[model samples]
Target: MKITISVEQPTGDFQKKLLALLADHADDIEPDATWTKERAERLYLALPTNARRIVKEAADRGGYVSADDLRSGEDSSLRGHSAAIKRAVDRGARDGWWPATLQSPVQAQGPGFGKVVGYLIPEYLVEVFQHAANKPSRDW
Candidate 1:
């Protein structure tokens, strides 16, 4: 049997959920076509600097990064600029540039249970995000 989904565009939240589901269950899902570096390059050029940076860092680490990681250090680029980072991430996810989780905190075993956090992005999109960094930054 074959199934089809028809929508002009999936909403940002919907896309994020879909991507997360896919990432979490990658072993169960298979694509009809293989993902290629060319396709990755095509997608990476359109992402914002913040998104690119996050992707690059996460890719370098191990394919997953939390918001706390980005903002942990005093000299971190994301330090004191979380709002902008969130916006950039949201935009990128909305546009299907990459997959990211919602900015929310997860409770730990002890201490600071209310810490707000960022979502996790998949490592596959790292190449695209990296390519975006090489592009010149511009303002309108």
Candidate 2:
């Protein structure tokens, strides 16, 4: 069955919050270069509990995080609900909050598992993340 799903993009206010969060962690994200294990770990440790979970789980597996990982809480680090994370990611991608690259229906093997969609955080975003960190927070 072919189906289309629609999600509302984040509002300017929310986007600003996200940007502030990104900027706050710009040093950790190291936006100018690719993410290395060391860099990822630093960011992982630096993130708030919720974001940490998502980033750690994904970074541990080559910078790609699947919906299943988020939903099932496969990694102990994942704190937020899968649906919420999914929504935030969808909006972030659509609104250009960050530059994570997303893909759908990648193959997998396991019970209760099937093709899955995921996101990849690139080095450039890492750089932006760092730059944003230096920016002042705005009230939105």
Candidate 3:
């Protein structure tokens, strides 16, 4: 059987939810194609800088990165970028760059969102997010 869904230039939250439903169901049909590079790229560009860094690191680490692992000599804030990290998906959804219901590229692991121990990028999105994160940004 085959199904065809056509919406005329969908927009708004309802549209977002509907699109998300379709994408989620894609997991059952063909999970690998759910997170395409183009979609990841669009959402990646819409994310904040810190959020992008977190995603890049997760991609590099095969879809899971501890927030503590992100700290470096120059950057001492080792608790992970909570504000930016938490807002990653919302920002993308609000901007209409991606579906609001889509799973986050960076999923924080901790106690009830109180403290993030780490971030997990979906296995399917690992390479897609990596490609998006590595793409050169506008140097203007």
Candidate 4:
């Protein structure tokens, strides 16, 4: 079944890091040329299932790196990479590989709860949902 996913635009630290990374790749590159939600979704679809799984699991765990983590310099690159993985998963969800209905309940609370429910959907499925949502007749 096709699932439709809606995603908000990337903002704040996520946007800044992405722009910096792209700028480092080449001179004269426009900061605005960085990947958009549509581009991110496509990249997510191209990833192998294993990579997608790693990303999805990480997102499920809410393993976001804080500013302190970056400043510490220990495992900084790893955390950045993980953050990129998270963006991909988020884009995949936006595109529809992961259905909104299956997303872990936002209102849910308690320790270890998100881990148990959030990882239920595989990454590939999230991608599917995202693509489905992008179809012409799909609603937001």
Query: Each model's number of backbone clashes?
Result: 1, 10, 0, 12
Off by over 4 Å in 4: 1-29, 64-140
Pick the winner on lDDT between candidates 1 and 4.
1
> Which residue pairs in candidate 3 have backbone atoms (N, alpha carbon, C) closer than 3 angstroms, thus clashing?
none
Q: Candidate 3, residues 1-140: lDDT per residue as tens digits?
A: 55645465677987989968888887565323255777777767766677778888989889988867877788757454645655665776676555555666677777884667788887877889899888886431
For residues 61-114, write the lDDT of model 1, one tens digit per residue: 555566667664565444333344455545655765444443311111113444
Q: Quote the lDDT for 21 in model 4.
A: 73
For each candidate in the order shown, give its overall lDDT on alpha carbons.
0.48, 0.44, 0.71, 0.40
lDDT string, candidate 2, 1-140, tens digits: 33322335778998898779878966665443233333333333344555545444554555466755566544543233333445554554465443355321112223444433554544334433333233343332
Please report the TM-score between candidate 2 and the true structure: 0.29
Candidates, ranked, TM-score: 3, 1, 2, 4
On the 0 to 100 scale, the lDDT of residue 114 in model 2 is 40
Strongest candidate by TM-score: 3
Segments in model 2 whose C-alpha atoms lie over 4 Å from true places: 1-42, 73-117, 123-140
Candidate 1 regions with alpha-carbon error over 4 angstroms: 1-34, 72-140
Candidate structures ordered by lDDT, highest first:
3, 1, 2, 4
lDDT score for residue 25 of model 1: 71
Expressed as tens digits, the lDDT of each residue in 1-140 for candidate 4 is 33322336777888798758767865644223233345434544545554343334433445322323223334423223334445555665567555322332112112552222222223444444344224333223
